[model samples]
Target chain A: MNSFLTAFFAGTSQGAIYALVSLGLVLVWRGAGVVNFAQMGQAMFTTYIASQLIQNEYSYWSAFVIALISGALLGALVDLGIMRPLSSRKNSLLLNSQSMRTTIPVIASLGILGVLKALAGIFWAGEERGFPAPVPTTGLRLGNTDLAITGFDLFVIGVVFLTLVLTTIFFTRTGMGLAMRASALNPEVTRLSGIRVGSVRTLSWAISGTASSLAGLLVTPKTNLSPNTLDLLLIVGFTAAVVGGLTSLAGSVLGGFILGYVIAFVNVYSAPENVFLAILIFLLLALFLRPQGILGSKEVRRV
Target chain B: MLKVSNLVTEFASIKALNDISFQAKPGRITTVIGANGAGKSTLLRTISGLERPTSGSITWFDEELTDKSVEAIVRSGVAQVPEGHAVISQLSVAENIELGGLFRKRQARGDLEIATKDVYELFPILFERRREPAGSLSGGERQMLAISRALVARPKLLLLDEPSLGLAPLISAQIISIVDELCKSTGLTVLLVEQNANTALAVADHGILLALGKVVADLPAKELIADSALRAAYLGY
Candidate 1:
């Protein structure tokens, strides 16, 4: 029983990390209608920057703080450079046709990805690097198993929980969040209501970027120190967004944790667990029980 | 008072609105009623700054508002309750209400909450289910939310498009009555657009009827409603 509980807690912490990344993807898609395939790269870039700051004797908290703000700034820059133009051109597009506009980001990210990859390979390639142990330890004794319950794990779980709660509060209690959501559904109507859809969209990118930065900063401490760390998390984050229902914030959080924990368990037990297997399972699940995943919304086709 | 003169809005090769002219006095419900493709929605879109007039002028309280953006128009005290599908399904009920008066910061928030209380008073159903996902609401409930949000904006003019669309007759009646009561209390001007000619005319003080983007009838709402010839030609039997 102790063993099971230890494994469960350990899994929960990791699941929280997945939720963070998933939340980031969901926000980007919701506000800008882009999948942000480059999210992983952005996170990787920020994570590297944060680690560099800490390694150079900068305080971890200050490093993390600077990284977070810069990540959001980077995200806004991407929006101004890429999303703003696409949105203007696609404003009058029909509902189904809007998805076609998504190609803009996908294309733009290719060039961005190349630039990032080259920079990572040239300047940042070191022997081995990791986060400055922001959380402290990684295990607690639970019967025979060494349950990994470090301060880092706790910090991650706390951050994810806080992020989710704060997001819910903002959406509910604040007027800005409301205007953003309203603008996304129908810009013209919200505009008529006197809401500045452009400013709302920009804010969306800012918020989502913060989430992305947190995920990268947190995840990199446990995993690899490569430039592609954020990239690897992308698959999971995108999966979470798809499961959660791309438009629903709550759905993304739930989807993120589920995917994270499920994959972790599968890796533990299954003999042939691979990324391909994960994709297969998700595809099957989407076909059968589509809306149960994170951010998922049931669409009732009006007659 | 609002006066639109020589308003022209074109789409590709077609003229959605052509040299349309009308006037809506302050503190009166001036409705625009026409057939499905008579450019009523386009005219409202233009006046609200969602669409720019290609080569004309829209004067709202004696200011040229034709070329401005939607946010500017709303700042200038014109708000629109767009079609039913425009409702943001993901937001909470209270948040939905809060967004209506968001352009103006201080008094808008406090006043909007008071207005939301009034909305709940008007549509008790909305109050009862104020915490649920807005998309979960029925068509009529969505209509109530849309109009209530617009009212919170505290606009000098409200451009409401197809408020009665896809709603049950009873529900439509309830919304219209609530709108009527709010207009009375707020002394707000409105340019309501609807294809339901008879019902729209009932709530409106004056009416403008359009055909293929041209004003075919400009008279009192009751006068147009009473004209059998106009009714047979556009309003349907």
Candidate 2:
């Protein structure tokens, strides 16, 4: 029973990090209608900046802030330099078809992932390095019992929860947020309403960058930072987003928690080696049962 | 006044608008009536800066509007209600209405509130379902929401494309009559594009009949309606 409790506590923290990463993926998908395969690479690059800053004796908080800013700038640069150009190539034969239009950007994002990974390798020498946790990692004590969750785990949960709340408010209450939602749904009508759709797309990328950066920073302490450190997380986060429904932000977060718990239970009851297989089977089951995702609306097919 | 001179819009080799020239005087309903392939929507799109003309110019009050961005054109007092009642279906009715006035720099909170109140008064059904998602609305209500959204921008010249596209005849007539009332009461310059020639010509003050991307006749709405031979030759009515 104590072991069961331990896995539950561990899963909550693991899920929070996944939620942050999933949130970023959903943001770009909703805003630009393109699945970004390079999300983890962007996160890894920004987290490395934070790691380097800390190694140079900078305060953890300051390094964290700088990394987030760098992430936002990098995201905007990617959109302006690569994604935007790729999307606007309407005259290209390869991009003229509807299926090709979505597929091509995804391929471009994969190319971006390769470039980002290569850049990180060149700059950081592709070395695995430990990242320090902002909060202590020692397990909390209650009376004579030691809880499985640490201060760092609690911190991760707090940060993810706060981010979810803030983003919810922004989307519901602010003018810019409303414009972003509007543009995502219908760009032509949004442009006709005097909103610059291009600017809004850029903003979406920036925010997604920030969210991914936060996920990177939070998760690095548990594993190790390297050029390819976040690759697996990206896959898991994407699965979570799919599970939640890519169109719904709240759904992504819920998907993360479910995946996190699944991972933890698989590790505890079975073996860590079977974790990936379990996740795959779970995803397949989800696809078969609810293809639109657990929270997604049913698509009304027009005859 | 909105003046379009020798405007030619081409999609590659085919010209959608071929040397289209017309004038829409202030405070008058200038309806552009045509068949489906006659380039009526393209004209509204060109005027609203959604499509770039291959040649010629669109001028509003002598201000050149040819190559301006869509957002810039809206700021310059031209708002288009696009075909198919293009409302953001996921958003609430109130949010959809708020989106229209989002870019306008209101001097005070009261200004925005008043603009919103006016739209609600015009479409009471929308007000009743303000909190509901726009997707839940009927087709006619969706059109009303789309119009209300454009009006919130407080545009000087309104460009409506196929406002009566898929609605029933009674609902279509209701929407057109409301537009007519708006033009008469507010002196709003309107360029209404429609495939339903009889309905549009009945309410329009001035009419331009189009055929194969060229203007067949430009006359008073009454005269255009009365000329059966001309209507048969061009409009196929």
Q: Model 2 Cα displacement at B102 (Å)? A: 1.1
Q: Compute each candidate's TM-score over C-alphas.
A: 0.87, 0.96
- Highest-scoring model, DockQ: 2
Q: Whole-model lDDT for model 1 versus the true structure?
A: 0.76
Q: Which portions of model 2 show Cα errors greater than 4 Å?
A: A298-303, B105-109
Tell me the tens digit of each residue's lDDT in model 2 across B1-237.
999999999997799999999999898899999887999989999999999999999999978999899999999989999999989888889999999989874444567788899999999999999998899999999999999999988889999999989999999999999999999999999999998888888989999998889998999999989999997887677
Cα lDDT tens digits, model 1, B98-200, are 6777777675557666766776787788778887777888888888888777776667788889999998888777777767776788788888898887777
Distance (Å) between predicted and true CA of A27, model 1? Answer: 1.1
Q: Candidate 2 lDDT, tens digit per residue, A132-200?
A: 898998999889988888999999999989988999899889888899888978899999999989999
lDDT of 1 at B177: 70
lDDT of 2 at B129: 100
The DockQ-derived docking category for candidate 1 is medium
